[model samples]
Target chain A: MTSDHDTPARPAGLPPYAIARQGRRARYDAASVHAILDAGLVAHVGFVADGRPMVIPMAYGRDGDTLFIHGATTTRIIRGVAEDVAEDVAKDVQVCLTVTLIDGIVAARSAFHHSVNYRSVVVHGAARHVTDPAEHDHALRVITEHLLPGRWDEVRPMLAKERKATGVLAVRIAAASAKIRTGGPVDDDADYALPVWAGVLPVTTAIGRPIDDGRVAEDTPPPPSLAAARRKFA
Target chain B: MTSDHDTPARPAGLPPYAIARQGRRARYDAASVHAILDAGLVAHVGFVADGRPMVIPMAYGRDGDTLFIHGATTTRIIRGVAEDVAEDVAKDVQVCLTVTLIDGIVAARSAFHHSVNYRSVVVHGAARHVTDPAEHDHALRVITEHLLPGRWDEVRPMLAKERKATGVLAVRIAAASAKIRTGGPVDDDADYALPVWAGVLPVTTAIGRPIDDGRVAEDTPPPPSLAAARRKFA
Candidate 1:
C-alpha cells in the first residue's frame, strides 16, 4: 500500500548531486529521505518569479516522497503560479525545496578547512497546482499533521470556501539527493600542532515546558501525544 | 571600547531579520544588513541554470551589506559571473539569501491552522564577481572566522596562490526584507473543544560537549575560549 504512494519512481540515480553531494553523500534510501524530512520542521523553498529566482522560508510537511506547502492566498508567488495554471498556461515552473539539520560544527586545525556537519535533502521539480478538492484536502492534512502529530483528528475540517481561498500546491519529489557530513573535522597533517582548537560541537533540538493559551479555562493540560513528545524531547 | 568592537554600529530600528524586513517592506539598512549576514553560517543560493532555478546551499560571510561566497574556481556559475564582469557585461542574475531561526511550533485547536514561530531574513540581489585580490582575501577571512569563531588566530593563514585558485565573489545585499511570525497558534473560538492537543513544541539549539579528534595528542586540552563556551552550553 505504501509503495503505491512512493514518489513517481525516478530513473535510478537520475539526479545525482554535485561534487559536494558526492563528497558527503548519505545513504540514499526512502527511509533516509523520510527521516530527514520528518526531523525537520521548516524548509527553505525556492522558485522563480518574474524570471528571478526567489526563496521563501515556510513550514512544510512530507508524506512518502511528496512534499506539501501552502501559504496566504495573497502571497505573490503563489498567486502567480495559480493564475498561470488557471489560464491553462504551459508555464515552466521550477521549484527547489531544501531542508537542513545542522548536527554539529566541525572545527579543523586550519581555518581554511573548517566545515559544518549537516544532513540536507535537496529536491528539484516542476511545481503544478492541485485542483482536485479531495487531493488538496489530503495534502493540507499531511502538512498539518507533519507539524503537529495527530492534529488532523482534533481540528475542525476545512470549509469549502476557506479551502478555496487558500492556495496550496503539491510538489512531487522528482530529482533529489541527500547530502550529509558527520564525525570530526578533517585537518592537515602539518597543521596538527598549530595549537588551534579542533573538535565537533554537537547540536540537538530540545523542547520546553508547554505554555497554555490564556483562553483555555483552568489551563487545561496538553494532550497525551503532545505531552509524551515533549517529555521525550525534554 | 568593547561595545564598539563587540557590536557593530547597528542602525536604530533597523530590523535585523530578512523575513521581517520583507513583510514590513523595509529597505536594506547597512546595520540590519550586516547583522543578518554576520549572524548567518550559510545561505541558500539560487540561480538559473538550463532555464531552471537551481538552489544550492553554501557558507557565506558579510562585510556590511556586501556578502561573499566561495566555491571551486571551475564551477560553471562562478565562471559565468567572472566572464560577465571581465568583459564589462551585464547578465541576468537573480539570487536570494535567507537566514532563519525556528523558535517553536504553534499548535492550534484546528489541525488546518498549525503554524511556526520563526525569524527569517531574505535578500533579493544580483550576484556579481569579485576579482580584486585584496577584497577577496578580506572576504575569505570574514567567512572563515564567522563560522569558526576564534579559529583564525590559531590556524595557518591562507596563501596567495591558494586564495587565487578558489572562486570568491562578493555580492551586494539589495532589495531585502525580513518577515517574522511569532506567538502561539490562532484558532477559532468554536474549535477550542476539539479535544486535540494544542501547544507549541518549543525548539531550541542545544550545543553539547566538544568531541576532540582521536588523533590529537593525548596530552592536549581544548582552548579556553572553546572549552569555556562548551561548558557554558553544557
Candidate 2:
C-alpha cells in the first residue's frame, strides 16, 4: 500500500540495527510508523542499571513528535536521572523506549524460517529529568488525553505536591525507526509437500463490556468518550 | 481467586525484594511470583553501555528457576560479554526482566487517578555465559518450544557453526518480586456525583480466523499443539 503520496511530513530513515530476510523485508514510511505508535497502549523501556541492561513495560503517550513517560517517584531508574545525584549508587543513565504490536504470525515450513508479523518503533535519545512545572503538567495532560481523549477537561488536575511526587520524562522521536511484517506464511518448497497447516493467526484489540464501579450513583450516565469507544468496538 | 490451600516453596525466610503487596503496598509471595513468570512469553532485558543503559526485548525461557537468553554473535551486548574476548568488558552483569499484563483500564472520575489493572513480575539476578555446547543446544530448544510447543521437533536442529555463533546466557531468578492491581475504578465518594464514566474496559487476548499458508500442501492438517491452543482460547 506504500506510494509516493503516502509519505509523512517527517521523513523516516533506516534502523540502526538492520536484518535482511531477502523477501521478508518490511517497507518503512512515516504513516506506517505513526500508525503503529498510535495503536499501542504500552511500551517496553530499556535502560542500564548497575552497569547492566534492564527493560520495563509501562504506559506512554505522544504529543506531536515528543513521547512522554510517567512513573512512581520511588522508581530508582527515574529518580536517578531526575536528581542527577547517584544514591550511594550510579545514576543518570541513558534509556530507550520502544513500542511494538504483534500484527500476525508467520508460519514458515522451516523452523528457522518462522517469524512473527509485527510493527515496532524504537526511540534512541537521552532521557533527562523534567524540571519545569508547566511543562511537566502539560506532559501529564498529553498522556491522559492520549489514552482517553477529551477526558482531561472532565477530571480534576493534579495537585502541586502530588505532581512533585511523581516523575515524568519526555523524549523526542528524533532518531527512531519502525519495522513491520504482514501477509501469509512463507514455507520452503520441499517442505510444502509435508502435511501441515501454516498460516497467519490475526490478533486485534477490542474494548469489552463496561463494568460500572460499585459506588457509582444509581443513575449516572457514562461520558460520550467511554460510551463511544465501547460502541465502536462492539 | 487466591486460595488459602496454596503455598509457595520458598527459601527459609523472605528475601528483601520478595515483599508482599497487601493494600496499596506491593508484597512478594512465591506462588504469585512464579505464576506471573510462567504466564509470560518474553521479557525486557537491560544492561549498561558507555554510562548509558540499554534495554532490549528478547525471547527467553525458564527451567526450574534459571532464565536463559541468547542472541547473535555480532550483537554488541553479546560480544561484550564474551569470554576470552578482545574486549575487557565484563561478560557478566546484573540484569532484570519484567513481564506485565494489563487486565483492564480503570477509568476513574479524576484524571490524575486513572490507572490500569495489571499484574507484573520482576526478576533480578547475575547473568553468566552458557559455555557448554550441550547446555547451549538445550537452551535454544527451550526458547523455541516456549514460543511454540512441539516446534522443537518439527524444525531442523541447529548446526555446529550456528550454535557456536550464538551466545547463550543464564540468570538465576533470585530476589524476584511481583505486584498486581485488579478491580473496578476506585474513585472518591464526592467524584461519584460528577457526570463521568467510572468503570473498567476489560482487555483480553483473542485469536482470529487462521489463514492457511499458500505454499502448504493441500492435504496438510493443523498440528495438535496449535489446534489445542486455539480451542482453549476459543
Candidate 3:
C-alpha cells in the first residue's frame, strides 16, 4: 500500500513506503534526515481526523530516533492518533511529519527548470501517546531547547498544572528520507547559451537583534542562552 | 467528519471542520489566508498515501480559491487524490495543503508559555486532477508568477514537451483557516516582574544578492524580474 506501485528500488534500511518515489532528489541516509530535522524549527504534522487528512504546523524536538510534539490533550492528534487502517495495528493514529529549509531560489533560463534550493526530511511512523511524566517533561524541555537552545534552563520549571494540561506525542522515525537541491539550476542545454541571466538567489532564515520586553531593566542585557541561540541562528 | 468534535461555533462562511480548534490564534477570513499563502514559498501538502498519511513540502501557486501543485503524472496526489470516505463521493482524492511563515521567536519567562510568532494557512479540500490545456498552462503561469512576480514574461515560455511531462492538481479550497501570532512574549504577571530579560527575536527569510551563472556575460545584470522579486522579498 506504499505510495509507489513500481519496482522496489529504494536503498537498504528504509521501509518500502518511505522509499521516496515522490521526487528525484531523495537521500535516504539518517545523517541527512537528522541534520535537516535538527536545523528545522517547525514541522508540518499530518494525521487523519474524521476520515480526512489534516496538516498543521507544530514545533518539534528530536530525541535520538523519536520526534516529539505537544499540545492540549483535547487536540485531534493528542486525543487519538485518528483511526488506524487495521484494528490489530500497534497504534491507531499514524503521522507523517515533514520539515523543510529553503536554502535558495534557483533562477534558470527556462521556467521549467526553475526550482528552489532546499533541504527537507519526511518521516512516517506511528504516533505514540506519551503519558510518562519523566518522558513528557524531557520532551517539553527538548522542544523548548530546540528552538532557543539554553533558554529552557534559564526559564522557570514546568509546574504541575502546566504539565497536566500539556500532552506529548512521540513519532519514532520508522521510515524517513531527506531530499536536497543545491547549487545552480540545470537549464535546457540549448538554453544555457541564451541571453537570459541565470543564477542562484540565496534564501536564508536570519535571526535579527533581540528586542527586550518593557518589564526588563533597561540595562539588563540578553542572557547567555539567548546569545547561544543568536550564534547558532546567525 | 471534520477534525473537531466541538460545537459548530465557527463564523459564517466556513465549514464546521475548517474551524480552528488547534490553538488560540485563528483567522478564517479569505484575506488573511490569501495574504499568508501569497507570501509563502513552500507548502507542505498532506494526503492519504497507501492507507497512511504523507506530507511533503511543495512549491504551490494560488489562483483565487484553488491551490495548484504540479509534478510527474505518476505522483500520488497528482494521479489521484488519496481516498474519499464514501464510495459515491464526487472525487476520491482529498488533500490538506498548509503553508507557514515564521515571523519571530517569542522569548517568554516560562518554558511552558514559550512559542513562535508565525502566520499559517491550512486548506482541506477535494483534489481535482487538472487536464484542461488552457487552465493547466494558466495554472503553471500562476505558480511561476506567485514565486517570482514577473519572471514568467522574462523566461522562455514553457515548452509543449515540458507540459506533457508535468501533471497539475488543483484543490479548490473547500475549507481553510489562517492563524497568526505576533509581538513580544506574553509572560505571567509575576514572571514579568522577574529580573530575567524577556524579548522577541525576529526571524526572517532573507533573499541575498543574485549571482550570475558562468554562461552569462560578466557585465550582464540581473533581469528586471529578479529585481522585482528582490524588492518583494527585501
- Tens digit of lDDT per residue, candidate 3, span A104-154? 878888888888888888887777777679998999988888888888778
Report the lDDT of model 2 for residue A192. Answer: 69
List-wise, what DockQ does each model earn? 0.34, 0.36, 0.49
User: Top DockQ: which candidate number?
Assistant: 3
Comparing candidate 1 with candidate 2, which one achieves the higher lDDT? Answer: 1
Candidate 2: segments with Cα more than 4 A from true spot: A1-30, A85-93, A227-234, B1-27, B83-90, B156-167, B231-234
What CAPRI-style quality would you assign to candidate 1? acceptable
Estimate the TM-score of every prediction: 0.83, 0.81, 0.88
Model 1 chain A scores worst on lDDT over the 10 consecutive residues at: A1-10
Q: Which tens-of-lDDT digit does each residue in B117-200 have in candidate 2?
A: 777766777677787788887887776555566666765556576577677778777566676879886676677777676888
lDDT of 3 at B2: 12
Against the true structure, whose TM-score is highest?
Answer: 3
Docking class of 3: medium
Candidate number with the higher TM-score (2 or 3): 3
Model 2 chain B: which ten-residue window has the lowest total lDDT? B1-10
Q: Which 10-residue window in model 3 chain A sums to the lowest lDDT?
A: A1-10
lDDT score, candidate 1, position B7: 14
